[model samples]
Target chain A: MVEVGAHATAEPLVGASDWDGGALPYRVGHKKLGMWLFIMSDSLTFGALLIAYSYARISSVAWPRPFPFFPSIVFSSVMTLCLLSSSLTMVMAVSAAKKRDKKRARKWIFATMFFGAAFVILHMIEWGHLIGDGLMAFELPEEWLKIWPGASPLFGATFFGITGLHMFHVFSGLCYLGIIALFIKRFDDEDVEISGLYWHFVDLVWMFVFPLIYLLSIKPS
Target chain B: MEHQSKETKFFNMTLLLLAGGAVLVAAWDVAVSRFRGGTDDLFFVLVALLVALLFATPPILFGIRTGWFHEKFVIDDEPPATEAAAEAHAEAHGVEGESHGVSNRLFILVWIALLGLTGLEVLLGYVQLRNDLMLTILMGASIIKAALIMAYFMHLRFERMSLVLTVVPAIVVCLCLMLILFPDSFRLFHLR
Candidate 1:
């Protein structure tokens, strides 16, 4: 075990209110900190859209609950599984990178990409089914209107907007992982960890999206 | 050391202008809402402006870091003390070892927990509780899931307290501020 206070060259700032503890506030590289900042801002973007959607749902007298249990919910649940699995793989990739095991890290990164691509493909299929049922960005399907005559058309917009943006992120994450995997020799473990942070962030966003969008709007049997 | 490459300067300036413009527009929206007696609109618009200002901070911070603003603004970033401080603090707390090379089993455990929570959320959806009740439960569960993924999968749990403090609070506060619109939903519902 490393000795405590062995390397404490000066007196430690034990209880000072304004003590920064160190010159490096976060003890992270600039790139990692930049990614954290990006995630923070990007979260607000999603947060605004999500809050708007929830507000609309709550305010509307007749918001359409369009997703059925069999196909829509089931398919989305599977997609959730894919994302979760991908997060696990991403963690493994970072661990491998930290160990300087380039081959294992690249393999795990590819695995993560595979799951991410699968999620996107499944999401596209789900969107295809919705569109084929006459769902549009600005318009809801006739069937939904038949059930809830006063349903807001904004349903389609929020649904597609939020999920589409998430899907784009997943797709971009795949591309980002691909770049890392292809150039694993050049990048360091910290680089891998930073990318893993982005990937986990994508999964984290979906954690809210899945339940709020899919579960809340489940169709009556 | 004070000089920045042309590319870095261009990128910083562009981000500054973009975020600055968003803050301006959002602030205008808030003002219009307040003037019109639209409290609900004001809340959301106010939150939007906060988000815009939050977004603007990173670029301004970057500018300060890279000495784009002024040399006076840049703090002394001497290396030896900072590195030694970090290493000593990490060593004292035994944070260095666990921060890296976390076991795969722990990650798999977190994965299973996330899956179980997702299943629970789906089942709760099927049970048909009251709208607000169900929404609360699902969001609670989702938040737990998000925390797990962030802490374990993203290794935030292994990170320094400073980083955790810096990252978590900002997002949590922003999200909570947005929730000021929640009660306004009932107001809108009543109006309808």
Candidate 2:
């Protein structure tokens, strides 16, 4: 950590009550709170996208029905499981760090990172299959006479746009986890726990996306 | 100490039951798929319901296993001086000291209720329910699951009520804005 005076920065008032084992006043710090506020704002961005999606769905004449062709549940199911398990490992990592079990914390962090990687891989495969089927991000596959007779471009556009944005977030989160895991030794217990909080937030977001983007779209077929 | 051990056992049993529920649902899917060839859509709905239930089970289980659900940050039972000291320490540090003994049995019951909701949704889908009805049921389930997670796993239930209050308004406003604004935009675009 940088020395408090090296940068000649303004510091909070130092009083006898503020001294607590050489830690900050709160168990949480300003930096962590700032990150959370940023996340909350970003969540609004997603909420807007989803709202736009719902609007598009409501206004469109034909939606090509959202299930069966899209989501490909088997692939998504695996990915969802991977992300969920990563959350469990992340919580375990935080628990270990809180107990000051450095080795266990590192192991759990690595495990969480591994699961994150697996989730990204599965997502890539799902996207590849969709693209291979000619479902372009902005363009839809031509309506087949027999198969997918009612398929429309809007389906591809909305599906890709929503899931693609989510994928971007997932990839970014994976990178974040990987970077943190690399410096696991450097983080204090509190810092490690804060990292875990971010990881859990990512997982929590996916919990919503998995159902909304994948499972809810499943039509009877 | 014995009570703690018993609680632990109860929690473990709850996890096992949830896992067993998932396995049973999966087995049912396999069996029905093999014997009944024409009910593919029904089967898919059943499987989807099971998956949603399975996804929701873990967070509740985590809260139970971690003893977070019933954990109290303020110790009302302690002597006033000790309590005051702890409260002062907590306030100074902006931390809420919590009791570690959470009731696992309560979590298990919550999980079971969630699973039941999932089952209800699947049954509704099977009975040729209206799309709006089915959607509302599923969304309701999602809301319940989200609430369980935020309250239990995230420990929002144990946190300062002010912090909790601060979050809900933001969520509600965002949701309302998205739901209302998008449709209006689409309607305007259609006119163009």
Candidate 3:
């Protein structure tokens, strides 16, 4: 009891001063950390799908030639371009938000969502054409009889599995972007930046997927 | 904080250029395929890499030339006291202080190297290089690009080392899982 009152008074001052001066923008919060953790888990999910695809590819006799079975490169290329452009727009939206230009931020975010929607629509069209040609996950191809004539079901299974999963992600990401854009009008700068992180991450994942699924497997028909 | 608006123009210009380049590349790819044989997977990969490089290059270069690369988002240590109080109330834990002196020239150089390696990948495809060698080269380019984006654009290089330490281990573990699981699947198919 000799000096306890004095020490208690001193402690509050130190704590208050520390609280007043030290804070950062783009700081990690519970929500941000949770989102990052979710992204990490999602990365693992994609990793598993990619591993499965690789295993099926390595073990299959007479792997299906992706060039012929898939739609023309031109169509997929356009879709890829759309997605990439969306990434750029997303960065711009983030930059705008950081400047506290909510109006511009909303515009750029809408642009990003638009591009994302275009990508999903194009993918849907491609899937429709492919399904019409007797291609689906786990479905054995009739063309295998005419082409390789000795191909295994693993070829089609892995192809559709990996690409279809990626497509599902693309669709979900579009929806996410759409919702984020809608909220842009009300969100503070920090919140907008947080949403931008997720949007950019989605774009980044697609950047890897475009090459792996669509580009890496293409050989001469 | 004050520098944000000044940099916005540069960022917007870069975005426009990237969008334009993407459209051009898509059109060119389509046009080239009509006259020659259709684009293959390898070719498409090269094109995509090229587009990424093209999109990433201008901001890095312009920032370097204009000396804006050294600018940081957090311009001042003492923000409005009220905002600071509110931030503290929220208990947002982020890196304090501004990031400065990020080397834009170095980043651009890295982009160039990435693009050059992509070109080499395309050349290798035409020169009939072995598949393994070609893949190795292409993947190497991809790694370099990823490193540049993470270290520079994402500012991981300047941030807390702990963040990098945490994220990298997860990525490596994911890669290992891929390596292990893929071969097993291949063996089951009897292709391996």
Per-model TM-score, in order, reads 0.74, 0.62, 0.62
TM-score between model 1 and native: 0.74
Find the 10 residues in a row with the least total lDDT in model 3 chain A. Answer: A1-10
Q: Write the per-residue lDDT of candidate 1 for residues A1-221, one digit (tens) a residue.
A: 11122222233343321132444445577999999999999999999999999888878878998899778998999999999999999999898888889899999999999999999999999999899999998898887899999898999999999999999999999999999999999999989999999999999999999988999899987
The model with the greatest lDDT is 1
lDDT of candidate 2 over B1-192, digit per residue (tens): 222344445654676576667667766776777635333434444554554454445445444434455473432444436443444334423432222123333334444554454445434444565655656666776677667655544444544332444565566545654554343544554685
User: What is each candidate's DockQ, to 2 decimals?
Assistant: 0.27, 0.07, 0.09
lDDT of 2: 0.58
How would you encode candidate 3's per-residue C-alpha lDDT over B74-172 as one tens digit per residue? 334445365423443222233232213222344344444544544444344345556556566656655665565455434355433334545655675
Better of 1 and 3 by DockQ: 1
What does the lDDT read for residue B52 in candidate 2? Answer: 44
What lDDT would each prediction earn against the true structure?
0.80, 0.58, 0.56
Candidate 3 residue spans exceeding 4 A from truth? A1-27, A68-71, A219-221, B1-129, B148-158, B181-192
Task: Please write out the lDDT profile of model 2 over residues A29-86, one tens digit for every residue.
Answer: 6666665566578777777776666666656655554345345666776676676567
Query: Which has the higher TM-score value, candidate number 1 or candidate number 2?
Result: 1
Q: How far is candidate 1 from the true structure (C-alpha RMSD, Å)?
A: 11.3
Which candidate gets the maximum DockQ versus the true structure? 1
Clashes of each: 0, 0, 2
lDDT for position A19 in model 2: 24
